[model samples]
Target: MREGSPGWARLALLALLGSILVPLVAAGLRSVLWALVGIAGLALAAVGVWWTLAHTGVVRAFGVALTVTAPVAVLALYATFGMLWPALLSLALWVLALTAARTASTRGRTASGQAVAEAPHAPWVLMNPRSGGGKVGRFHLVEKARAAGCRVVLLDGSQDVTELARRAVAEGADLLAVAGGDGTQALVAEVAAHHDLPFVVIPVGTRNHFALDLGLDRDDPTAALQALSDAVELRVDLGYAADRVFVNNASFGAYASVVADPAYRDAKAQTVLKALPGLLTDEDAPRLRLRAARTSAEGLQALLVSNNPYGRAVDAGHPGRRERLDSGQLGVVCVRVDNAAQAARLVRGPRSPGLIRLSAEEVVVEADTATLPVGIDGEHAALPTPVVCRSAPAALRVRVPRRRPGTRRRPGTSRASGAAADWPRVTRLALGPLLRQRHQARAGASGSDSGSGSGSGSGSER
Candidate 1:
């Protein structure tokens, strides 16, 4: 209708129909029962996996067995019933339908933005040479920035980035830009915001979450440099934990604890696997109490406070991405799954009691311990109890290329996150055009009748 894609909606509906019909057609009515069993088994497998991560000894071994067997059992049943192909095909179609539905729903949506007329006169850029496995050197970002008439400073991991930004500002730098990870981006962004200067982002980091949210091209770091010539300024919010700034998010409890381990940097997967059982089950583990506007959650095993709320569905392209950075609210996701039952309930999606998602202007996290370990933008820290995480609404002026891949504002195009699709919403959107047309026809008929009545009254008066 007014927005989204009708073509994609048709495709999504077709795929959805196929997802259901394929299994039924191939394996008859019994396939429905088999499908239900498969779903239950998957849910059980999820619970089992959670158990293995959160328990030790016999319980952990049993969880491992359950995790391995549940999915295998489902497959075995499908194979024995000669419904394996149909089941797999149905699952694939369902996934495709969901993806198409998301695209259809989000299509044609564009973000409101402000255009910049003039470029910065004296823009200063900071590049971390080692970031993204030396992306700066690999792309020759330093030389390219200088070529674009920017004063460049290459970070050697020795100097304070905040001080560098401050020095640049003191020396009459008009704009601040960074070609590094989110942690470094936060450091410079704070300085830029303090000075009320425009900040630029070059997505040369291992994971440029901020850049992606801003609709910048993460694959082409050099494309961001074009902003110096033609730019659009977006006033976005920044996340803060106490006095520290975080462009992405501040993590507490399980994730923070994992990052705090000295061995994490060397062997991340091994470290997380080794530490999960203790962190998830230990009674002595730091329990966090989180308070936000109109809501409070206690005894959270892990909590993430982001600059803006992340979409419920994970984006196949960019996992854990926020739909908008300018929401002026902190996104809070609290997890407290303590048992297999609670873990199994996760199949209910966002409605599960074990998982909580909300948004607030501010959040306060309190812990029994005097200091709590935190992971701010993937960097570990220890913050005092009663840590305050707040959103600074429209605090940073982010300069981005006017023409970027992720921000093309056109019909059948959108800046919205292609995360998980909401099926109900998608269904409504698919029917929107017909609904609008019917309403319009009724309104027009009513208007005509009113007009005729008015004309008759005028003639009678005359």
Candidate 2:
């Protein structure tokens, strides 16, 4: 069974209980010994890596030393842990289970490739050479685009991307593609939507969250080039906060403040730590008024509005993945507390008491200041107070590779939700009839045996 299924969950619970109880009843010392051995193996591996990297001895001699001993040490540790077969078996089984889950989840939903290899018009690709540390140049994206018959435009930071996209569309570019960060993707996607051109995402960004959600292979930008040949067009929603468009999410309050910090990009942890003390402790922190659904809150320290709702469970396979992109609603999360303790608790569990999370077609955030600092798709901006966020459902048409690497559903799509909701019924329908037949057969057999015994007894009396 796939992970998180009822069968798998039951087995996991049993294993966990057995692990705790069986040790107490028997071989307690052996379990402790195995734990120690595993810890020792990890420590030894760390030491090996450090020694091989940090030692300043004779170069060739050090290489020889590491080359000779590292494998031996690893093998020794493996042998100490019962010949390593069990570990290998466990790893193989884990891989098999993961593959099964992915396959089961994507059975009939994933797009398939057809051998057409045609484009309506030459595609214009907007590439930011500076995005993801010059990923375009590093990956030879221009050469690849040329090979794919795409007209490539290098964004030199001089021209407005929106205008550039407009010009491309005017000049007979039927399809729009971007090889840049989410910020650039949003700008180009907006233009694509306005022109009714199919959009393609080349994930050359630091996060590429939008691309990831689209089920594109974020690891390899070249993989997306295949969409030009064999593609599947999917209609997805876009999120707008004020005049700005965001592909992933927009953030207000704490996250916005942190991203707006001058040193945040280079020193994220330090910047957050420095900003947290004042943000949490200041009683005069600007309170944000939020109205969504039937919930109204004032003085919320932070607000996050996503294009689609993220899964509620922290341990879900894909925690922040949108089940479907055309959900037609904005996922809003409100943080009511301004204290560090509350923040810590939230990190410990997403279901912490002070968090109010919900999905809505629109969310309005009012602030005391004339302008509120907001982080839109990881880029910081200042928007006028009373910021209105809304979902533009099916606003953009995205061209993705046929047989996309990881095809999954978005949050609010009724079909996906209905499938999940109807799983219990489906399972019962498949098994319930067989169970009833078995019970009837067993009961009939018992009745037949009783009748046969009564006849035998009557015959004996005669």
Model 2: worst 10 consecutive residues (lDDT sum): 411-420
Instruction: Please provide, for model 2 over 1-462, each residue's C-alpha lDDT reduced to its tens digit, 9 standing for 90 to 100.
Output: 112234432333344344445433444456566445544544444343333332334632454465566556655765675535544444454444433333223212212223345665689999999999989988899999989999999999898999999999989999999999999999999999988888999999988878877778777999999889888787888999998999988999887988999999899977875676467446776778998878788888888998877544232344445555776888887776543344334533446766777899989999989999999998899999899999998899888877666654322121222121223333444355668999999999999999999999999999
The clash count of every prediction, one per candidate, is 0, 6
Model 2 alpha-carbon drift over 4 Å, by segment: 1-118, 312-320, 340-350, 408-462
- lDDT to native, each model: 0.85, 0.71
Q: Give the runs in model 1 whose Cα sits over 4 Å from its true position.
A: 26-29, 57-62, 107-111, 313-317, 408-424, 438-462
Q: Local error of candidate 2 at 19, Å?
A: 8.1
Residues 1-462 of candidate 1 have per-residue lDDT tens digits of: 235677777778889999999988997888779878987998999888897898778887889999999999999988997989998999899888877876766632223467899989999999999999988888889989999999999899899999999999999999999999999999999999999999999999998988877778888899999999998887888999999999989999999999999999999988988899888878787788999988998889999998887766234566546666777889888988887888888877788898888889999999999999999999999999899999998899988888888766432123444444667777777778888999999999999999999999999999
Q: State in Å the error of residue 139, model 2.
A: 1.3
Per-candidate RMSD, Å = 3.8, 10.2
